[model samples]
Target: MYAFVSVSHPDEIKDRKRQGKLRQHAIRNGIQRSKADRAKKDGVFVPVEMEGKTTVATKRPTNTVALTKAPSVSLMDPFDTLCGCPERLRSLMRHPSAKQAGEPIFCVEDSGKPFFQGMETIFRGALTDPSLFHALSLVLSLAANNNLPNVEILQHRGEILNGIRVNIKGLKGAPQVSTLTAMLLLIGYEYRIDGADCNTISMHIQGVQTMMKLCKERNVALIDEVQRALFWQDLLSCLMAGTPRFLSHRDFSDFKNPIGIDQSQQWQVPKGLEESMMHWPPECAIVLEDLNALCWIVDSECNPDQEVLETFPIDNTQANLESRLMDLLRECRNNPAEPDPWYEACILAAYICTYKLSTGIWMGCYIPEICIGQIFQVIAKIPVDAQYKPAPALLQWVLFVCGGMTERKNIRQQVATLIRERYPDPTQDPEQEWETLRTTLKSFIWCERTMEKRIFIFWNEVYPELHTVDSSRNKMLVV
Candidate 1:
């Protein structure tokens, strides 16, 4: 991935508040020197000396050092390369005219444009450029379809599970592409072109899903791509607010009347804690990094006393229960936070749970009491759909947990089960239920992990080395 490091001039340090006064003191001493020069004559300091000798007066050292304010030149080319940018773009980053000699460096370009304009421009360019767009799409598709292992699938097959590992080596040399939207388009193209191989298409889809998920997780914006167009800030808000449990007790009375605490108290919470609570229900508060922002939003939009406090206790309990249940849907599948709006919207759908049979805690721990009644009324209408159907993985997880294949309610359970048709005979030894289950799940996970690692290692590491060796002979012959 392309990244940047910020650079600043050393002279800017002197003007900092802690050092500004010292700098001024030094300047004043220079003024004193100038004053002493005026007292001398003919550009030389001469003094009448004893015994009829004349001598020049000692002069203080100059305080002035050469200072040049120039636009950063070293970084210009690399930045240009990253954007697929031409020379003209440099004008956009340069100062319009020279100014006072001592100001800290800044992009003198007009502030009328947004900070992300450069990113947007490059994205647009990538969309129009075929080669760049194709590479980006492939990268995104790969990111979307990543699936880690589950325990049950392995144990059923007499296998063990290992942890998942990312092939960073392959990622490093992958084709370069610009713009999130372009990447998605390219991924779609790959799927269309591959034809007939459902597995290959599925893999491409996963990649795209991963890319979009990462973008959402990172809070990056997809300004205007048709494939993914969510703004980063909006995605985060959705992630925080869409939980049924968090929304269960939410005040529907209008933005002015919030469900939790009075507006004033909301400001007291830390930001990182509030954000961390995004994955948690409303009752549990976490210490967060952006406490100040949390305070601002709560004070401005939320009013707890008018909402939750006024509700009946039984109603509040029901609402709390429903929220917990809904939150479970968000975890049912692995979705990366990426800039793709569709993937984000899909993840957001966890709040609108009607398709499957779920109870209060399984939904969301913090869903408002009122919404539960609302959702409870219309759950029959939601349709069940799983793109790239991860039934196999799901099956594995269920088997690992339950210890065998069984159905609980409408949900499928995949645990290893120990069954007794009748009372056990006195002569029979008791079955080792827990250890067998653990061993089985462990084996299942290990097998899946092994395959995934093999694919990644060979493609990312082994293949590259082999390719390098193969190319060496050809290069020598050409030379």
Candidate 2:
């Protein structure tokens, strides 16, 4: 769960246009960084020259090594020791990645990469805790199947649900870390499978909330890991339900508003936001500043120490961002600014960030449909003509975010076409397009490390005929 922070040197910030590079995830060592640096300078992607597993090679993990928990693991090791990752998940998350074939575009399969924060600790408890093992096993099964509940998943889920019903009656509150982990696991599993609004999911969330309240009554403090995970889930659930977050008494007092370094100050506006922001509702702009600040925290402060985390929790920052946007939308619902694509695009980007970054469930979970629908609406309303046209740079960012949000091939192809409509130069190679667009997106709220591979994929998909000759070669060229 360590963040992939990609901070740029301060002295070079201006000359670099405050652009940050996500150190490549596939090659989690310094060698990849050097290659990526060279690629950036030359405006190209250079694949690692490896013998067995090429940097860009990706496939299903049918006959691969079993990803069981190791005795010890490196932070960059994509596999966790306690909770073994299934090969199927590892395949989908492979950096030279494509989702498992036939998988839906924006499904739970697209949750962040394999390794996550506090995962090791949680699984360590599973070693001796039957309940935690069952809960965690069910979650891994759900994720492995892309949240589709299979026979085994159903049986396991039933056991956990029924057991909780009976055991919860005699509880002395959120009694143990293992107990809390199992509960959180079940809450995450139900939400991804049945959605946040489902009565079952709500039941889990409320039960956790009640337990936390009871623990506070007895003055038993939760460690940071469990506290952070619970806080993140509750905030996301609140956003989905269109209700204010139920930050429990303990979490509420412990967590404060965002306190990270403010990189959005005098933020260099990208061409996209630059052209259209003047007309945006004032409130939206305020939220955007906060949005950039959150993006910076998530993107650059990857490995914050405990004290740093205590002061500037990423979860609180995201919760605040979502709340502000929802508030602004409420105020504007009466007489919405007549379909300003730029206006809606900014908001859409913010929602995507909040969901994609902070949804503590690393594998499977539902992103609320509220923002998903708005993505299409904004796309359809995009003005094609030059008169009163917003910058394509904005569209590029919006469409890329929207593409990441959807699993439908049609939607993705449509995104490439529209993006091409603005850039309309079949003569341009993806390397150049990515380089140009990459710089433009940095000015907006984006995480390059998380998105660079997707950007390359979209660019290639949109212009496969750009003299690359061989399609497979084109995709691999960027490896």
Q: In candidate 2, where is summed lDDT lowest over 10 consecutive residues? A: 98-107
lDDT of each: 0.29, 0.55
lDDT, model 2, position 231? 64
lDDT (Cα) of model 2 = 0.55
- Per-residue alpha-carbon lDDT of candidate 1 for residues 248-286, written as tens digits (9 for 90 to 100): 223222221223433444343332122324444343231
**Residue 92, model 1, lDDT:** 30
List where candidate 1 sits over 4 angstroms from the true fold.
1-118, 131-174, 179-181, 185-202, 205-328, 332-378, 381-479
Q: What is the lDDT of residue 66 in candidate 1?
A: 48
The TM-score leader among the candidates is: 2
Best by lDDT: 2
Q: Write down the TM-score of every candidate.
A: 0.19, 0.55
Write the residue-wise lDDT of candidate 2 on 219-284 in tens digits.
Answer: 764445566667666644444443344554234543345445464467443444655767777666
